[model samples]
Target: MELGVIDLVGGGGAMVAVNDSTRTLRRTRSIQLDHVWRALETGAWVTAGFRSATPWLSSITGESPSASSVTLRLAERIQQMPQVKATFADGVLAESALRQLTDLWSFDIAGEFARDERMLLGWALKFASGDLTMLLATWLLHNDPDAADKTAQEQFESRELHLSSLLDSMGRLDALLDPEGFNLVRAAIRHLS
Candidate 1:
């Protein structure tokens, strides 16, 4: 028994069809939103392609559409924050970290420091790990206004040392690696800069 099928045609729209075996009836709906139809089509193609290429994904249920949709919406909301966008564009923030920050807090940190986006981006990039970045964002989100200023100052000072230690470790590793491998690392660091 056939269940349902959805077809998205570029520049046209989405065609959805449902078949009911018991009633011997078929229903169809056309969705005209081009952007929405295109997104759905892309998502379907990605899911089918991934499932076909990965043998294990066929056995286990893949990432749910609802979850991916939520993440995409959250990312769109986060991008509205100039500081968040800047950090992400600078390669200092990971998409997963931004999602975690969105899940942890509702307020806009970027709006809070609209004039200090550079400072905010610098602080965000100071964290060597995404977990640390999320923790810092959470701290900033929940801290009282009076304490936030002092806390931000202290966090920056303390985190600077941590970042310095991380850089030292990377430098040591770079010294040990082959010239070609170290050159790749240098290129990545240059790209981040």
Candidate 2:
């Protein structure tokens, strides 16, 4: 007599079943990622009459658009980094952590990441997401000492303020400010109001 899943609830093999289920989910995700990459490379979505892969993936997989978009982005990122893809395939990191790791990859730091991929992956396993982010920032500072200044300058350059009248006679204010500008505006509002 074979045991069913219901029978495994209070049985000794429950943990094994749970672990196997988790691994299966990870393996399925890995396979889906591979297929997504292949579809992008081969323009399968276009052939299927979709404008882009995100909608196609969402429709086909019954996942939300945002989730599919994230998966597509991660697939693209991991495709460029073979070692990271392998780690993900092996279920070394959970999806949230892997998303964080892939989000950190950029052309500016690709070479450095490739060189230290194993160490960083180990960190991903050990550190919380926020700690991993800080560690990566520190790593970036070591590689590029001017990164902080460059980022500040970029923020300053991109600042904007927009004022509009809403339909119900309310004013709408939209602003994007650098740290210094934000402080100045906050102080002015406090003084005036």
Candidate 3:
């Protein structure tokens, strides 16, 4: 499936437009991503509801999603590759890794900060390519204590709501990865750049 950027969206099927060609993939409103997780593991949902955007996807004639919602959802999913990789890699993950990875890569993909763009891209590509060491070290880049602590710190005191959402998703994902597994540190990581 074409795991690229999404342009237009609306409420029959979703369309994924690549640099050269454009293709449409059909989906259903009930095609919840969680169901995809039900049948597979991480990186397995490569083209379930995403086929509409990626022409190479198999025809999953299960459900139908409006063009707008599917397009938006596909785009959102593609956007989370970096953080998802972070969440799946072995070891306990903190919310800061999720925030920093998302923030850095989102800006990179959007081309908002060319000066710092390459730096984020490098980290994302490394993470996606299974660079476990770099993914683990990402937290170090965010946390600071003395001259800035490189260690992960708890954020339960200040960002209860933020942590709530972050943990909710990560917690669900954690369970998906390991049904009996769960990470409850309950905090977001802060990166000092």
Candidate 4:
């Protein structure tokens, strides 16, 4: 049964909603924030209107040369925020927000990462595959493209992989997006197009 919903703005920049069942609808609560609401509504409309998209927003966040270091740092901070993280865990953040947060978090995660026996991307790619990485990267960047480094340009410069192994193991960047996230990327591609 559809439950009655109440949007309740809380202290500390948080918004909450109590469903008829007393559970939270975090996505609905996020819409109470003016800027986030705008991002979500606009992204949703773009997706509905355009079915074919190129994920320009995602690309811009992670690989665009024009993005600056400061932007990426800001994105990382945003992703790390408690409210945003909670919303994300609850599946409330918009598609773009999720991508943006994921991208920024990746940068932070990557920096602290120490890989000896296990490569982070390799682990992700092996069991989870590149699509998951793609999805996570998309979410992180869509939330903030400027926050991601232009690693796309330099990925090859720094990474020395046995070409055969990489080719055999690497899944397509496609199929990475989760359903909601996929829709967001599609809208981003269309909006930019």
The candidate maximizing TM-score is 2
Model 1 residue 4 CA deviation (Å) reads: 52
Candidate 4 residue lDDT tens string, 1-193: 2222234454412323233212244443333233333444467436645331123333433532222222333334444345554544454343344444444354444443322112323333233334556655554465446544555533333232111223668643323334455577699989999
Whole-model Cα lDDT of every candidate shown, in order: 0.42, 0.78, 0.33, 0.39
| Candidate with more favorable, higher TM-score: 2 or 4 | 2
Quality of model 4 by C-alpha lDDT: 0.39
The prediction achieving the highest lDDT against the true structure is 2
TM-score of 2: 0.66
Q: Supply the global lDDT for candidate 3.
A: 0.33
Ranking by lDDT: 2, 1, 4, 3
- What is the number of backbone collisions in each predicted candidate, taken in the order shown? 0, 0, 18, 13
Candidate 1: how large is its RMSD?
19.3
Ordered from best to worst TM-score, the candidate numbers read: 2, 1, 3, 4
**Candidate 2 lDDT, tens digit per residue, 55-117?**
799789876555677788888898767766787787656677788778667677788888988
In model 4, where do residues sit more than 4 Å from their true spots?
Answer: 1-81, 106-150, 153-193
TM-score of 3: 0.23
After superposing all C-alphas onto the true structure, candidate 3 shows an RMSD in angstroms of: 17.9
Report how far residue 60 has shifted in candidate 3, in Å: 30
lDDT of 1 by residue, 1-193 (tens): 1223334455323332221321122111111112333444466436655542122222233433333344344544554456665455444454555554444333444454455445545554455456556655666655434545654454444221111134446521212233455578689999999
Error of 4 at 9 (Å): 25
| Clash pairs (backbone) in predicted model 1 | none
Model 3 C-alpha lDDT per residue in residues 12-76, reported as the tens digit of each score: 13553332222111122223333443433444435344433322122343222222323233334
